[model samples]
Target: MSTVEPAAPDATTPAPAPAAAPSAVEVRETQREASRRDEIAPWLVALEALRRKGEPEWLAAQRDDATARFARLGFPTTRDEAWRQTSVAALARTRFDNATRGALDDALESMPAFRFGGAFAGREAVFVNGRFMPELSSLGKLARVRVRPLRQVLADDPDALCGLIGAAADDDKHPFLALNLAAFQDGAVVEVPERYTVHGPIHLLFISTGGAASHPRVLIGLNRNSQATVVESYVSPRGAHSFCNAATEVLLGDGAVLDHVRLQAESEKAYHVATTATRVSRSATYRSHALTLGAALSRHDLGVRLEGEGADVELHGLFVSDDAQLHDTHSKLDHVAPHGTSREVYKGVLGGRARGVKNGLIVVRPGAQKTDAQQQSRNLLLSREALVHATPQLLIHADDVKCKHGATTGQIEDAPLFYLRSRGLDEEAARALLVWAFAADVVSKLKVAPVRESVERFLRERLPAAGAVPGTRA
Candidate 1:
């Protein structure tokens, strides 16, 4: 081979400029193309179908933007920093069809018992397969409170819906949220005007049918000095294989107070991913209780932003996993203003080959002086193969702030078990007693009596020899 001599450069000629970097949009399109190769075409088809159904121009634009965002971010893999502890490869590989209509008649007739009636009474809004079913919903007589289907609200006032849809939770960071915004058909909308206090809790019930995927969206807003209590329950028929991607956004005005509870008890073969974002204004109080008891793989992302002075937030969560199930709860509380207070307690019980994860973070931004924040995560493993990962972190960039975080992962202490056994309790009974006692610390924080009772019932049904516990309320 003959070597070619290099051409000499001219003194008056300038070197060619380096190629410009790809624009953000172009880079995003490249990512979207790569993600589409991972079997995300079904979702793309679903979004197109929604657009072809004559949706409002504004809504369609929003959906298009969200779809683009989702395509860019794609599904999170184990390689992602935020998802390093969790893997959703199975969910990404599976081809899921969107739930377009309500549940079939036979499916509705064979529904399971309603365990949350006591908590919501007659003020309940029911959704089947992600579509609102007015016949099954009973929004009886709540003064100064509006509870309606989200689709109806959107149809009536697109502007109002647009204002609340992406108010909390940035879709740019969470791909599932972008998917939800792109494909959600119907959900619940609850609004409380200024100085109004709802008499009873407004309940939102989401029931999934087998096979298809459901995207549920919930938005709750409280005007100045308003108060309300809301409960959102997700369930599916036994043995159903479904996918549920849900998101809820809450906005609390000045001096407003809200008590929110979210319960996820899906089928064993189901996939459940949810995000809840709350913004608390001056002197507002926001309390949340999250319970995760079912699903083959589940993840809950809870975020609270204390944006105004004197805002208070309390978050309580309990998760029980068994038989190879994975349940994860990630919480972030940001104290951005002075005098903001936040408290978080999360507990997990893992049995069989199950795995549990709890990640709680408390952040005190600069100028957030006198911010009192505390977070605790406690986990118990009942089987040798069971595993739990607990991470409690405090990031403080401000001085004169009181912030503490603690995490513990271990098996039940021998001393407590021995004490219970000495009191004539069997091994199973003692274990159940200890587990319930651990979970009760979070459940008892629920101020609502009926809600607490329902959680107790759920735990009793799942725990071994739970009925043998001494007291009625664990």
Candidate 2:
């Protein structure tokens, strides 16, 4: 037939042969992919602005890597193995603007509650909405230790961060960590030279204001035989609905000792997520005191690697949740060398309809003989509506390792309550005394005086009844 060749279909015209319809699973997956994209788009937008800055090539490359990793990892869902018991859907659903300079309210800054005295006033790196504020901060006459802002290092000597910036944090598998690496504006960079001892504890104070998202980063390096203490604290105005994604990486050189304290007391309307990674060298010691409260939802991941012989790690964790708040803590202790020792204890106090979760894993690798690891999770539920979930695990590949894990979750024991009541205490005071006892084990681990006082103040403010206990102030 001499039929003229059909004109090619126009751009908008459909082809004569129709494509096969997508399967149900394929359709569902496409929707999920789109949702994930939506969740990450805001952060990408924020990163774009940061990329325009004249940052070092190496830092740019690191950010690019983190961006790719973030896209691949996406946001963790309850369907994921590690997130099965915790859902970040709310955090993922909200689209947040990147926090900017001048985000802190002047009136808020002048509030008596925000003022600090003693050690915190001595050496502090202050950040409001992820931007460093030198006006309100002081480096405390540092000698051999370099306690400067991350922005300073990124600009003055990015070479210093070549191997240290992203060393301990695993952004490849953790989306939040990747997000932080991609979007962090400024943070504290602490460097303690070998055989030196920092005069005082370095305080990293990060404040979150409502109406946006913040990314706070900290990189700490303690050289051989060096010693230092660091306190990473987060707080916000009451009723603020903000988002804070923080990451802290620490490297302890051989024979180094470091004490880390992390306190999170955000608004009940806020969401907080953080990751802390530490690598300990031969005979190095790492002590941690982690306390969490006040966020509507919060999750903290702590990972420690004993890279050389005789490395030791001791961790104390406490979480107090009320009014439907949810706190999730996940810790992993990896013993890679011989003669490693690790001890972990986490306690929880829940009231109202609150919930608490403690997930811990201790792994002893092959040839890591003489490894000793202990993990415990103790929880106290204050009401019938409160709930807690604790999962402690031990994975050992070496033959001569001593590893043990246990968890206890229950309401306040009647026996202890009765005893406290018999000691001329009212029901409320009695209950508070017992609760304090339950939490004292972990709270007492904070060695820094200012930190201890601050945490105690928070506990009292959160639970007025707890303030009436014997060992508390008005």
Candidate 3:
């Protein structure tokens, strides 16, 4: 028997130390950035695969800044204040290798919600994955607003998008925001010129197929005295593992009025994150109605800055979580000018061991006198294991401001349940009626009739936890 001996070390060279194993955080970070080579490029991350020729230097610089920011900050964990109640460990551990191409006709053939009708029929801008498919979208000219592809606008006249793209999403604290800004390939850009009004709501529908991640963004700019309504919806296949990181920037010029509705109804197995940054000018109004009811783990961060005097903001949200799902929301209203007004009401219903979290604040700057701000958080639990953590705060640095907040969490009143039961209604029916009574008001707040109808149908079909229709949208 012969054994090969190791070569003797040279006396002139120093011995190398044994390599150390990576820390848990380091391993997780590396896995989050895992990439695979493909036809597009050697670097195959959905984030790094994006490239454009002859793009504006400002746009390129913005993307570079976002990329560097995400690399430095990485993903937030449970230790972070804003992310304490929610966890992204599963998302970080998974390796997403594609951006999900735009060829998704077969995947969307069965989803009727993607099919727009009535007022939303001709005003739809559909995005598969993160790319815009002109074949699936309707971009006819409106009376006041022009719905154009953001990428096309950048290619044609980059100057039109200089300040509208990243003007409000410059937050380094939001890793998902940075990721979306850095990687977004195509999105809708709705532009309303001065003194014009858009009679109908412009629907921006983003659909994600399975096995990949997508970064879809929206840029809406309403000039002086303009009015427009925008509805943004995110949906995916049922129980499909995917990631949808979306961002929307809304700039309301002076005297502008904008009505925005956001609907998140993703797959039960998906991970969803969204950030909306809006700025309101003098006498401008920004009203938001957000409904969150999907994804295994979902989170939404909304920030509205009242930059001009007499600016107003109204926020209304309804989140439903069941079957071990987790839904989280963090919202901030910054009153930077006097006479600014803000009103917020967020509600959640948790069942089947689901969990809900909300952290919201209304901050008044020193000079923001007469800042009338009010916030409320209401939650209802259907089972003993269902839980919700709500924090509605008011931070006032101004003296003459009226800022107040309230939060309430509890189960349905037994008196009402008994009353309904005495009326010959079954237990599940009674509970469903009560839950609908609690959730319907918020759904009505949405101005889009088609979206409102869809939400109402989902509520009727899936509510009353014990009677939840299997295979139906949760």
Runs off by more than 4 Å, candidate 3: 1-46, 99-103, 465-474
Per-prediction CA RMSD (Å)? 9.0, 9.4, 10.7
lDDT of 1 by residue, 91-163 (tens): 8888776543544553475443544544465688888878888877777767668888988987787677766
Q: If both were scored by lDDT, which would come out higher, candidate 2 or candidate 3?
A: 2
Displacement of the residue 453 alpha carbon in candidate 3, Å: 0.7
User: What's the true lDDT of residue 151 in model 3?
Assistant: 83
Per-candidate count of clashing residue pairs (backbone under 3 Å): 0, 0, 0
1 or 2: which has the higher TM-score? 2
On residues 1-474, what C-alpha lDDT tens digit does candidate 3 reach at each position?
122111223325233335597666566645655521121122225456566667899988988898777776677767566788898867866776564543365446735656545457678888878778788777574655788878888888988888778798765678888888788888888889999988878888888888777888899999999999999989887766778889999999999999999989988998999999999999999999999989999999999999999999999999999999999998989898899989999999999999999989787878889999999999999899999999886767779999889999999999998998899888887888789878867987887887887788778767855353223324
Stretches off by above 4 angstroms in model 2 are 1-22, 106-115, 464-467, 471-474
Worst 10 residues of 1 by lDDT: 1-10
Error of 2 at 156 (Å): 0.7
Q: What lDDT would each prediction earn against the true structure?
A: 0.84, 0.84, 0.82
